[model samples]
Target chain A: MTQASSPPAVSIRNVAKSFGKGIYAFRVLDDVSLDIGRREFFTLLGPSGCGKTTLLRLIAGFETADSGAISIEGEDVTARPPFHRPVNTVFQSYALFPHLTVEQNVAFALEEQGMARDAIRKRVGEALEMMRMGSFAKRKPAELSGGQQQRVALARALAPRPRVLLLDEPLSALDLKLRKEMQIELKMLQEEAGITFLFVTHDQEEALTLSDRVAVMQSGRILQMGPPREIYETPTHRFVADFIGDINLLDGEALPGGGVRLEGGTVLSAPHNASGKVTVAIRPERARLAPAGEGALEATVVHSAYLGTAMLHKLDLPGGGTFLLRQSDPTEAAPEAGSRVGLALPAEALRVLDR
Target chain B: MSAALRRFFLLSPALAVILFLIGVPLCLMAWVSLLDKGGTSGVDWSSAPSSANYVRLAWEEDFDGTMILNTSYLVIFLRSVSLAAVTTVLSLAFGLPVALWMASLSRTGRDIMLLLITIPFWTNLLVRNYAWLIILREDGWVSRFVNMISPWPVQLLYNDAAVAIGLTYSLLPFTILPLYTVFEKFDWRLLEAAHDLGATRKRALLRVVLPIATPGIVAGALLVFIPCLGAFVTPALLGGGKTLMLGNIIQMQFGASRNWPFGATLAVVLLAIMLVVMTAMALWRNRRTA
Candidate 1:
């Protein structure tokens, strides 16, 4: 939530970055802009090489943008060095100082700020306790496990009470079970700290699970930016819909009469303004299955997978395209493999993406 | 064969070399250091073993057969120690920045610099000392240039300063190489962590880099200090024989004076000092780790 009278926590405008020069130059970020509200959990979601990390680095003052301005809490800090910025980063590798103990590492920034020694001790203890690393105060980072080290890194960054905290795939190193546990801890930590968190990750589930708002990036540009549900359910770009979740995309032609005609001569009455060749995306759970000759579309059931809570059926459409149906009702028996079945496509669920 | 016997057999060649090359000479030196001088053979093996030569280090017997305190050798020992310390400090000062710069270089650039650093090793140490002699001599251009701008005419050679300069120049690479190895493995991201934590560049260097590079610093100091303490050629040439170190005094006893027992005594004392320093360093390292 943002108040109109107050400035956003971080505002980035028209930032561009390029590496190298001459014929070998690579543009990593091009005209990227966004605003992170105060105390909001904002995530940059993208595959590798999409410049999400570069944008986070630029915001942290670790990098300089080729053009445009970055302001933190209404202060333009584009010309300042990282040391002058009121931001801290939880590095992907933790990057904990090996020679310093956990307590010393957590107190590093406070000491740099010239705080009183007693104050530093108090803050460091509190920060370590919050991360459940209070007992590891005198231990070196090398002696700690990877998850413990990550907690120490988070404590070190949060100890500074920075205006914004930047996390660069901080959980990508953990195992599946630990990662799930950490995701919940990270959300709770962000709420308790009350600082804007600008997280970067390629994991779609993590982005949706933890972020208040998600900005999906590709090729150095923000393809879509919205709440997780909005981005997931109403992705305006073809890349967003395909990247966000498992969806069935079908090639079709949009008629002037406001309906799409599939390649198999099947017409689905979905209201769209586009005409000529188009692509319609639908999530698997939005469609259902029926007995043969009972529904609008025809398909042959290829296989069925039990997903604990749901059954996923893979079917081959008449025009050679495959379709998916998520059957979550336990009472319904799934169609057998190689059996003819009727598939239902809802007009309200079909999303016509603008390429 | 048993594992222990097999291991002994595998290690026999190295053990035998150590015994012959190091152990035998040490035994011979220890025996010589306890005997008296012979009539002509330089060593009186039949003479009773005594601490006479060892006592000579602190008290030299006068013609009246009374022992008196001797400060001459003490002065020489002290000079050797302080000069070695100065050389080690100077080497660290010049080597650290060079090592840091080398570490920051690209792969090819680092290789080229490493090759350049090792280039001086190809030249003989004697030749290199002579080169320094030419550069520091009274009539040399470097001396002339210094004298021109100096408030008074300063003698650039035949002094402890000249000896220290020569020692540091010779042993600088000892410090740089070890320091470079530590710095080469340095995680530069730690510096970024320091900066992000609001540390200025100088603060980061002192607070983080220096502490992390402590092992290399101590190693470099030892490498320079040990050799500089027993340095003979640098003092002989640069000191011009007037400013004699322990090394020069020991050389005098063995060469012109031909006092074999006393020379052996001086060598033993030097080894004792080396052992003490090494032990102290090892103890300090252990304490830090603990």
Candidate 2:
């Protein structure tokens, strides 16, 4: 929280980009703007072709914006090439040179700067040690496993010690077990390095786990940008609520007395009374399974799934929709697969989204 | 049957074809290299097998008893090696970037480029060489262009330069195809990685792109060099009987001179040198990859 006042590490304003020329041109990034603070792990989260990777590339100076200013540490790098920018990228493929050893790969950026030989050797050694790949410094990329190659790529990018590091779906190639391990390692590493990380990924769990703040993008536009809890619980856009996780969206009307009136006149109290039509987004975990006729909405349990850590019960609402409730503590007298049940939708947990 | 025996049994037909086509002829050539020359009658194989043709290449048994170095044939062999090296280098110089460009093109564009390359092969090689002759002749288009620059129609038909240009042109597609295939599967993001690591474009081209493309370069070089070493029609038509390479001399031994044993000896020597160089290259490649 204190690091939020350390000034913006990267600021992009009204940036627009497109590919091709003339009639064939297709805009990839709309007028996107954001301010990422120093030492903050910021993520651009979206599905494929959401322009998240394109936005990350724009900040890295790989692509120039058609119009707008991009400032890194108060200096405009809009016209600079990637080599001239004080930034580095961990590419999606972990673009390690197959011909070069890990040590040479890590030392490449400093070597290009014409740094002192002794200093380069020391720094390369330190970077390799930091990634716990000191023993594999002499090995080529083809010889290392996928996870090791990812670590080596991380070491190479971080060895330059740029003010900000851009990671473009760097963990997408790893398997589930290794990806989980890398997610934890990457978050801890970013914290230790004290460098602002601009990560791009389509995985919501990864974004929520690693990012201090996330900007959910959809079709070249940012739908919402906030901390994970705010974005998940109080999503301003329906797209964000559905995309971040599974949600039960109920069409409702904003009542005048600080509540939402559903289609069947079931008024539920909420923090605010939005005018006109709205949608109530109830998170699966927040909506719980309760005894029959003792909860907010009466429903019948249609089915259930055992997810090892949590049991998901799919309930059919009385009016017309299905509400999914996730129960972590399975010790309660669980409702049978076809039993009558009710969903407890808390007033605070219910988010009123504008249509 | 064992796996090895079964594999050999399956490969016997191809091996038999190679043995009949290449190995049998090579053995016959080796035997012919050992025959002594006859006095206008024919090769006197009735006498005995002898190494005279091979020894005469180095130490000629002259009446004056002087063992002068056979620098003429040595020079011809060296010239062929140097010309082949130059042809390979030139082909690579032109082919690498062209192949890279072709690799960058769309699939249909690349297919069109490949079709254009194959179009050249539709014409007979002899006809193509003759076309070069007319194009390079005095008072021709090339000569007229030269006259505009130098006030004189410079001769470009009968020299090493003409042969070099012809060799590079003929073998360029050979070099380009292998390199095109290499760059086709290449991940271009490595260049971006190089740029992200502060390498300038030139540095990335040299350190990253060139190194990754070495195997393709070697494949292209071999394709250009091996054929250029024994290139017959190009030098024959372009040289105009002046700049005789080993190919023209070897042809002369078989057709005009009727010195079959000596020709066989020259073929064997050329084969030995190529084998040595190829073995050395294979060793170097293994070492590099390791």
Clashing pairs in 2: none
For every model in order, the fraction of real contacts preserved is 0.79, 0.92
Docking class of 2: high
Query: What DockQ was computed for model 2?
Result: 0.80
Model 2 lDDT tens row, B1-290: 99999999999999999999999999988998898656674455666778878877766655798776677787788889999999999999999999999999999999999999878899988898888889888868887888789975578889998899888988899999999999998999899999999999999999899988998998999888888888889999998877778778778877788887888888898888778878888999999887
Give TM-scores for every candidate, taking all chains together and pairing residue i with residue i.
0.96, 0.94
CAPRI quality of model 1: high
Worst 10 residues of 2 chain A by lDDT: A1-10
What tens-digit string does per-residue lDDT give for candidate 1 at A1-355? 7667999999999999999998999999989989999999999999999999999999888889999999999999999999999999999989899988999999999999999999999999999999999999999999999999999999999999999999999999999999999999999999999999999999999999999999999999999999999999998888999999899988889988788888778887888999888888999999888779877689999999998888988999989989988998855787889999997788889898654
- The alpha-carbon lDDT assigned to residue A220 of candidate 2 equals 95
Q: Model 2: runs farther than 4 Å from truth?
A: A1-7, A21-24, A288-295, A304-311, A327-329, A335-344, B1-8, B39-42, B58-63, B151-153
Interface RMSD for all numbered candidates: 0.7, 0.6
